[model samples]
Target: MGKSDCSKLHIAMFPWAAYGHFIPFLHLSNKLAQKGHKISFLLPRGVQPKLENLNQFPSLIQFFPLLLPCVDGLPPGAETTSVVPLNQQKYLAFAVDQTRDQVESIFKVIKPDIVMYDFWFWIPDLARQLGIRPITYVVVSSMSAAYNTTMITKETTVEEAMELPPGYPSSTVRFKDEEAPIVLSMARDFGSGLTFYQRINTTFTQSDAIAFRTCREIEGPFLDFVAQGFRKPVLLSGPSFPETKTKQLDDKWVNWLSKFEPGSVVFCSFGSQSELQKDEFHFQELVLGFELCGLPFLVALKPPQGCSTVEEALPEGFEERVKGRGLVYGGWVPQELLLHHPNIGCFVNHCGYGTMWEFLLTDCQIVLIPEIGDQILNTRLMVNELKIGVEVERGKNRQVSKESLSEAIKFVMDKDNETANKLRANRAKLKQTLSNRDVQEKYINSFIQALQDLVKK
Candidate 1:
């Protein structure tokens, strides 16, 4: 491969069934296509309709949609993880595995230069068998990835199993023995005979190269940890800032947000994948946290199972009393636009990677109330590592109290305390760097250069 070879690289994008995983791959594909490379984005037929940015890229980017195979437990036409309930995600994985023959056939026809995939860790084996290079596109933070790899890649003795990993931040944060259940559950619900952690190890070992949605400026040490641990070419895919070119906002939401003063409203959301119904008391505390702060708020509420309406989901008279100050909508809202709005002063979030990047794009302060998966790790990065946000203290049962939530909100929103002022200033600096178009482009270009270099070997 020579310098001129960069122009003709045919890349195949096969992301996991979840929207969080799919969106980053889409962004990367668009970037690759812009550089005169051909991109074949493979996804299920049902997912194709949900991609609003499909037409934004050049014609070089082609969508190769496949009909999803039905599994016994999975609902009909439920191709993406977003449509499937949280508990039933494993069925989607089973369905995706069933498409092995179909995907292999597409590979034979298109004969892509490289196949870039997410979470479907078995793809590297298939790509090798087909004589095409394989790339693993990791969507989580480097710290989360490193921690997970350290925990799962080797057999652990009884003592090591109960303790946090050697290099983990023990003083700042530690995983309790009880928390083992949470980590273990991610491995349990996968469709493959191998656990999800095992798949991650396999993917790292099998792929030609690995790419992450991060840059060295923010996560240098953790990225180095992964590179050294895996002993492979770990590429930085930038934050893959989502293209906001197609800004679609509903008139109802726009009109509603207009009433509040600039940087005064709190936007609350916990992304699509989280099962937010821990307990009724927990839900009440979350509502009261906003009211106690006396801030105008907008909540994109996804009610727990069996609760159809927000009124039924929340406490009685809760909506009626907060009618003027808060609005609770039960469906989709343009989150990108809402977060960018002038009135949104704080984002009370579940600390998902996708949502974290969205908050970093704005000057809004983050109020981390992490629930599951890598969210706790992400929250620690924001709160302890970066000093950009405040974390609300959860009680013995990992439930947030209203008082603690209010305190965390004020710590970010008020800016009266020196600590709060420093956090805001630091966040402003990060916002400048993370939101820079040129910086993100540089990372993307470097990744392509690395990929081009890999082909030569």
Candidate 2:
């Protein structure tokens, strides 16, 4: 098609339907739509509420509901990609395969010009079959993309990731001696083992371009490595978040947080998908520690199935002890809004990329408490490399103790901690470096231009 004909290029975005993936894709879709592209957002039916919130962008975007096939292990009508159990390898594989088929069917209906997908196995083939360009959208940092796509190997398991090479960038290192074993086990047992890596390589080869929600300035070395190694067009969308001009606060949460002094409240939330087992008492210890610290807090709590109730997740009479001081919500809380609230001071986070970026963008003091996957690496980056956060020690079983949690929170939130001040100062400097409007616009425009170039080819 010619340039004039491309005035309204139809782009289909298939994010994994999880909050982490969906939120970033929503931001990208909105940006592309603002640039005059028509977006068909393909997602599971369950994501309607999330889609509802983005109703303002309805003019340039359309929603395509994916009806996931009912499999033996998967819950009936579960659509979000993150719903897959951590241990269920076969079910995840089947779901991915099914999602690909569903996406292909949607393509036939929409006939989009490009198919932008989150990291998945079947996207390339589907795109090729439809004569549409496929773009890989890495929602995390370029460093994360590099780690997953390049550094990870069967022989170089998570255990190996724990011990950093002296003087290496801390962001590139991993924690938890048990991480390697867990990853290796996950990769081997649940995933198609190393086969998933082979598939990812194939997808990378077939993709027309790779796009990241990272700036070259933030992760310059890793971005360069990826660009040089992949030999494919790499687009840096950098901190590609939807702009919120004024801070909006949840009044109740604001009132709750107001109970604490400035730089005192510690907000705790692991992203939506992180599920803690019912038997996991470490979570309880963290809560106890939070109570012991006497910090006013807001926690988004979700326990495993049959234990979904908040009371079920907390220790016996936990809420009673922390009552009037803590606010625990069952489902979604407006996170970005909460982070910007004045009364809110520090973050106790699971280090999900989305959470990390949101916190970083706001220049908030952070306490890194990573749970799984690349989170350990991200924690190291924030605490060790950036010196903006502190890490809590995990016990012999790799569980964090109440004392450790309480101490870490206290250490970071301490008014006298020179390290915390230095971190805040450094964060301010980083923010200034990244606050260029023209530069951000240039990156976005450049990325779109690269996509357009692929179309011409």
Candidate 3:
């Protein structure tokens, strides 16, 4: 009933149990740590060990592991989404949903000034019950939030789901006919008797304030649309990634990349979650596209489904043909560092939010082949709105053709291509703005002030 008083807020960070979600929350926590805020970074017990190496300010950002509740179909030790296949990820979601009790217990102990979370929609109610503010921090672009992300129920028609929300900012953000179903699919039953739509819609509507890892300069209209729709304070984190102060690319990567001439190597990485099925013709098309392009490439992706190893899945003589110039390995590679490598001329990717921003900051030319729903929207933003990249054309059934992939890469790589030249100029300007410290600090500062103001409200 009264204006709350606080200083140096102790915020609890509970992200979705996925590397993509966890890493961005940590990046924000790292930024907040610099401002002297204490963070209680909560995650599954098994995942803490993996994140320890990444915690830059372990002293200030403490890890408080939660005992992950097991689900019937989930694997014995599977704590994150990475261990689960795409079809079976609902089991992982069910497991995460069961953590509300555990989360509430910890919240009672910490009595954090705020609970910053994503995916766990129940957080708002729990935070309110404990008299702690809950902040729903979306790591994805606001454009996706405004255009593609909203309340689409199982009962919602395909046509309705395809239609943009009322007063949505951009007409340019249209989904393809084949891509329209993705919105409905995202909204379908994920787990815990809730669709992803209901989970996000509830959180967005109920959270004390909403935050995004975005800025007003580029995503201003979409951000405004979200604010208007939710009728809450929408704060921006401004793409504040953890500073890689002393980190360097591994020697093996450095040495291998050095062999290629500057601005010659094509780096292909489809995030941690992507795995083309061995049976799918596109998997072969993907590698063959690299061969067809005749460019030096390094692909970092999981081995396809039904295959135990990346080597086993390769087409006949495929490895031999591209042996010396190209490499396709499924292992942890430092993508952020590699993006800045001298030889990385072009980056072919799936356009995950974190990856998109990371690649945008680099001099590497972008060639997008987005697979998932959000990735498709991100690709549209890059190719259609920002004009920063070219997307590989997909067939009616969303199948990737080797010719299309090769053509997209070649188009961007062409020295004298007009469209490529335009993309380069636009991207250069954007790179300057995005990488500017002052612009970024202004957004983060505003976000902090908004949080403090919310306490007063």
Candidate 4:
């Protein structure tokens, strides 16, 4: 079979419908395709057209668009998590669970050597029946994954998880008292006939091996902990870096950015997930923070909840007060790609795991303001553990004030200050480590070799 030639093996990938999971799976598929392996990428029908431009190796990687079946409680035409809000996303997952037969049919026909997936815990059992290996690949850090898996079992209580487990890899990794409810929410039924906790636990327990989009350099201790705890091989695919081919920035952005001095503009983005509610002590204050910082800034966010447009949500005279120096666009932009611009010296973001890897590779000073979930933990990894950034200070109730947010931005931007210099120097060192092409190559190559050995077994 294809096991004889690992380079020519066929693989299939099915990630959770969210962009956070889907994009990283595609990026991994692209890496495999570059090494002469073929990928059958299965995603929702509508999402296919959206991700067309990112399919750099179209000839070697084919997209099989599956129409998500309808489920009760899910709104009409809502297939992905991005379309439906978090609370209603359980219905979307219910619809995905209904696709089991369709997925099995495709697997039987393709007979892939290995199948990789994030959610859908039933996948490992299905692959075994079809005599194919199944690997659960997570996009989150091993630190997050290991900690969550240990502390969030099916029998876990909200009160129990509020305290750190008896023995964790790092004491630096902690859950806040106020964050207990959000953490406990994982136990809620997610409509896939499983709670979020059960689904994740089952995936790890059933999969032949677990893989992560991380390197030992960044998460060595946590990786070891996961391997020992799960009693399975843990493969590292390393971090995905920007490829040589780059997307051209728009003329308007180029012209505007060129007018500013090098390393002077603040580029703000919160990924493609949330439309921040204006009153969560998030949107308006964050907008005013950039204004208060007096930096030339570009903030790309959806119009806040309760407002029809970004212009409508701004504080009184906010538009006029920072007329030429600021912008708050209500649409998606190439903000991640723009990190290369010399004029973009500061990055303000939610510290998303994938985005953290991205910003870590760039020279821009990081300022974090995580909204919810593991993002807060990722911020701790950045601000406390790595010491490569500063976080916007949170109050007793975890709310961030305009002045505190502004101070975090200004702290990173102060080039002459000793603390700022240390942050930059630490960031530069980490960037060099991640940017080591040889190191990254070995991780991917070793990952593929692990798959071949598993198939042979």
Q: Give Cα distance to truth, residue 339, candidate 2, Å.
A: 1.5
Q: How do the residues 1-457 of candidate 2 rate in per-residue lDDT, one tens digit apiece?
A: 2346455678888875466778888888888887788899887776866676764478888888776677777666666557666555455556656666677778998898888886565787778888898988878666555554543455655555444443334434554556666555434433334344454555566687888888876667667766666788888777776766565675777677777777667788877776666555455676777888778888876764457576777778888888888766678788788787777888888888888877876656788778766687777767766667788887876778778888888877777889878988887777776676777788878777778777778
| Stretches > 4 Å off in candidate 4 | 1-7, 151-155
Lowest lDDT 10-residue stretch of candidate 4: 1-10
TM-score of each: 0.93, 0.87, 0.96, 0.96
Candidate 1 per-residue lDDT over residues 51-143, each given as its tens digit = 845545758888888888878899998988778876677788888988888899999999998999877777888998887899988898877
What is the model-wide C-alpha lDDT for candidate 4?
0.85
Instruction: Tell me model 3's lDDT, rounded to 2 decimals.
Output: 0.85
Model 4 deviation from the true structure expressed as Cα RMSD, one decimal place? 2.1
- Ten-residue segment with the worst summed lDDT in candidate 2? 186-195
| lDDT, residue 242, candidate 2 | 76
Model 3 ranges with Cα > 4 A deviation: 1-6, 148-150
Q: Please report, in order, the local distance difference test score of every candidate based on alpha carbons.
A: 0.79, 0.72, 0.85, 0.85
Candidate 2 Cα outliers beyond 4 Å, as residue runs: 1-8, 89-93, 99-102, 150-172, 189-196, 245-247, 278-281, 303-308, 316-324, 327-331, 434-436
Better of 2 and 4 by TM-score: 4
lDDT per residue (tens digit) for residues 1-457 in model 3: 1124346768899998899999999999988887777899999999999898878888899998888777888998899988887667778888888888888888888888898988887888889999999999999888877864467888988888888888988777668778876777877778888887787788788898889998776789889999898888889989986785578888899888888899999999988888787766467779889889989999887888778888888889998888789999988788888999988999999999999889888998999988777888888888888889988998868888889999989989998999898998999899999898888878777777778778767
Q: What is the lDDT of residue 432 in candidate 1?
A: 91
Model 3 CA lDDT for position 357? 86
